[model samples]
Target: MLQRCKTLIVAIIALIFSQQALADTAWDSYKSRFLMPDGRIVDTGNKSVSHTEGQGFAMMMAVANDDRASFEKMWNWTRKTLQNPENGLFYWRYNPVEAQPITDKNNATDGDTFIAWALLKAGNKWQNPDYLKESDAIAKALVAHNVVRFAGLQVMLPGAKGFNLNSYVNLNPSYFIFPAWQDFADRSHLTVWRDLINDGQKLLGKMHFGNPQLPSDWVSLYSDGRTVPAKQWPARFSYDAIRVPLYVYWFNHNSPELQAYKTWWGRYPRDKTPAWVNVTTGDTASYMMDGGLLAVRDLVLQPANVAAPQITAQEDYYSASLKMLVALAAR
Candidate 1:
């Protein structure tokens, strides 16, 4: 009896260690695959280019995994390479192949939010005042530059430049970044962030307007009190819009705004759900939904007890990142 008990304990210990190993391996593999030595994160799906969004995602993930070294590396790279020191905002994109790596200096609001949120979290986790100060500065800059009162509610522009077209301003609903907004609201004591959240939820509720009734990737907020899909962008619920539900679910799983996504997605069989939908043309994507998207679908639709799917080597940067995020939220 004693010998048998000893063997069982050994087996249990091995299993626990194995499980921990697997968790570490997943994060380690993600860092190795997508994160460069210099801390830039490559968007594998987007021609291996680096973007502020990617860097922010990486920094957030690093914090989630409690990898302070990785977080610092990513932050350092971002500060050195992408930050417009004059304004404390980051440039949206960097193409290593180009003679001028940063061809555009526009600040993507969503990217700024993500980075600020990550910095705040890292500061709290590591007790670093510098990170917190930087985050606060970025938050203030966002409020000063990217946000505007349109149609009687505060709304975040997708970027600092080119979004305002005379009487109308272009917006991406997915860029709302609900959790980050909430954090900013609390940290900055700015009612605008709270107002933005409320307005964002209202915008999200109304943007779903098609046969299937889903939010478009881009929308226009007009001066004369109208909101519709942007004329310049395709009227589709594609890559950008897919993130809406994920953010909503993360911030508030019981949110009524999330129900629209759940209901619309429920119409299609899980395996047959397309990667995107053209709300204007009523056309679906040719390809099936990827693992990351499917993981998000399951997360939003299923009960919390159901375990999130594991990340695999086959997945790309975006998909793998989504899977990791879902796993983090699940915890």
Candidate 2:
């Protein structure tokens, strides 16, 4: 009888654990803390106004919850902050209240690209001309500024300026090329799609290196398409680079290269390791929340051509990750 009772208790305990795992308690906590007073999705720094990424994520969440106010707040904020008339490209960062660029240089084309994507969705959902127009302008700027053709790789760079063929190539910025190109193909019906895919494949092919076999944030490129060592590359992979797989999977679902990459990341997976990961070695280096989300994302879903093994999502990680997942999934 004692043995039987012990077995029953074990079963009950397992059931309880499972229930806790799938519980909505974490979701509730996230909803309360992350969302804004007006029901818009917000970053923790509520004192400052919203950002394009935060607004975009908020829009996704709002759409998920059927929250009209949240959606409007996001859409309005994005349209105002991202659109720039002088350069015809979206500014990378801006103050919410004043709607002015925060920094001198535009950070990455991907920021605008993602904003364009969210805006495009908003346009579709509400049939808004303003959203469509802004999205098109950002797409135009991304293509205009970033495109450069080398012997083998036709890719996008961090900013539109020097056509340095001998410069080192990083998969981090290159990953944005696909998303921007996809958006361009979608909006303008251009013939750049083939070039975009080729560029992506070539870059992905070049990312693999080293004894333990890890990819770096950047790679040295020769005019002859020979990959070389450029010590100028950063040691860590930011949140931006980590999303390479996410973007790739979203665009080319069936690419073998992406599939292989995903499998590779899955093999040596460590989602909770550190905020900043070494792009070259896949080593955990630093710890910041923004970069932390990138690793956390791999646990839930990865892009094509990147591999990441799933790990037990910790309580804190799960709470943070699930909220982002919910936001993204809702879109």
Candidate 3:
């Protein structure tokens, strides 16, 4: 009877492992393709460069997949390679082909927030105080360096520099990173995060442009609080603004901010949806959105149809990351 009971326990454990394996199919594919042995995630679509955003995205996915080992690998590499000793924030990109991989020392605020949020989450889930401690340090630096007041509205800049021109500021709508802000507010008990959430939503609500009413990829706000499509950029609702709705819906599904995205996306069928649009001139991408963008569109429009996500073998790093993010949001 003792042997039989032991055998039954072993069988149950095996069954549990098998079930978990079945559910982690997408993560497995993503890791096999993009994740290098050194824990750097490659941007296959962008000449195999690694960035803080990709590192944060993978770390978050590792936590979601319940893979602590993978998360540690990514965190270790990111901290070693990208982190700037002067500040807790990471440099934006690493080009392996360049003599100095870190060509840009400027920090991307979204990546910093996501990394902190992932660390906070991993620390909570795994009951490790070390991860939590590091997360706090990073979070403090992020709040100190990136979060700032522009035009009487508390807004986050695209990076640490060049974005704040004293009299005006450039904001990337995608960088608002609503879910991370919410998590920071809950965990750190910081009023600034809460304030950011409220103010960010309001600012984004006023950013829509053109007849279709879409936000541009990059927007500019003057000291007087007036907004326009950044003169320096192409003034299109392209890659950057594509993530705005994803973050917003993840933070609050019923957000009025999603209305513009929903309206614009609703005009096209799932397969025919354009990759981007010129919010000012009404021009649109001749090519359609990739699998990841489609996944976001589906989630934004039809929240109830939460099907399991799959990663195609040919899917690029960014698209796969987006699809995985949508799957997490769906859950």
Candidate 4:
């Protein structure tokens, strides 16, 4: 009996240590592969360019891993490099090779939300008022510049500029980062965030297209109350839209909104999952869905055994980020 008890204790201790190692490895691998020593996070798939989205993702991941040093480094870089002095919003992208790196000063609302959300989480975790203050500033900026009333509902613009075409406003349903909006609503004491959340869900429900009925990366909301896939962009459920279900599941695993995505994705065998789908044409990319996307799919659909796939060295910045996010969500 004594020997059996000792063996059981050893096994438990090993399991705990193994779990800790796995957690550490995920963030470490991400930093080594994607994050530069000076703090910029490279989107390896996007010509190694750095974007506000990647920076926000890094900050959030760093905070999740409880790596204060990395979090501060990334935040400082963002404030120095991306933050627009005229407005608190961050620039959408930075091309390092250019003499003027910040050519496009417009802000991506999703990126802004991610940065604000990270700051808020960091503030709460570290008990730092400064982080909270910065987060509030970003949240206010988003409200001032990005939120708009369309078709009798408040919605987030994909960017601070260029989205409002003459007859309609273009919206990206994935830009509605549900968890971030919820946090901002609670912390900033702003009812707009709550209203945005409700309107966002309504918009998402109406945005579904194609045979499987999934939202596209881009959609148009017209003054006449029509919603359709944006003609300017590909009418497909691809990279950007893949994040919809992930965010929804993160905010509320039991969300009714996730059912359509779950049902659509369930039609394919796990190994045969397509990288993307052209909703209108009934066409799909030849490549299979990467492990990272598959990891998120599993989390959203099969929550009980939420096992994030192991992060491999070959995975690029986005995939690695997804894997880390899954690991964080699982915890």
Best by TM-score: 4
Task: Put down candidate 4 lDDT per residue, 198-299, tens digits, no spaces.
Answer: 998888889778787898999999988889999999999988898888888888888898888888889999888898888888799899887778887788
Q: Residue pairs in steric clash, candidate 3?
A: none
| Candidate 3, superposed: residue stretches over 4 Å from native | 1-23
- Backbone clashes (count) for model 4: 0
Q: Point out where model 1 deviates above 4 Å.
A: 1-21, 303-309
Candidate 2 vs 4: which has more TM-score:
4
lDDT of 3 at 309: 67
**Candidate 2, superposed: residue stretches over 4 Å from native:** 1-52, 60-68, 95-101, 161-174, 177-180, 212-214, 227-230, 258-331
The alpha-carbon deviation from the true structure for residue 47 of candidate 3, after best TM-score superposition, in angstroms, is 0.4
TM-score of each: 0.92, 0.65, 0.93, 0.95
What CA RMSD would candidate 3 show?
4.8
Return the lDDT, model 1, position 22: 70
Worst 10 residues of 1 by lDDT: 303-312
lDDT of 2: 0.53
**Per-residue lDDT of candidate 1, residues 43-126 (tens digit):** 887788998888888788888779999998999999999999878899999999999999888999888999999999999999
lDDT of 3 by residue, 1-331 (tens): 9999999999999987765675598899999999999999999999999999999999999999889999999999999999999987999899999999987899998888889989999999999999999999998998888889877788888788899888889899899998898888888898988889988988888898887687898999899988899999998988877788899889888988888888989999888999989988898889998788888899899988845667898899989999888887877
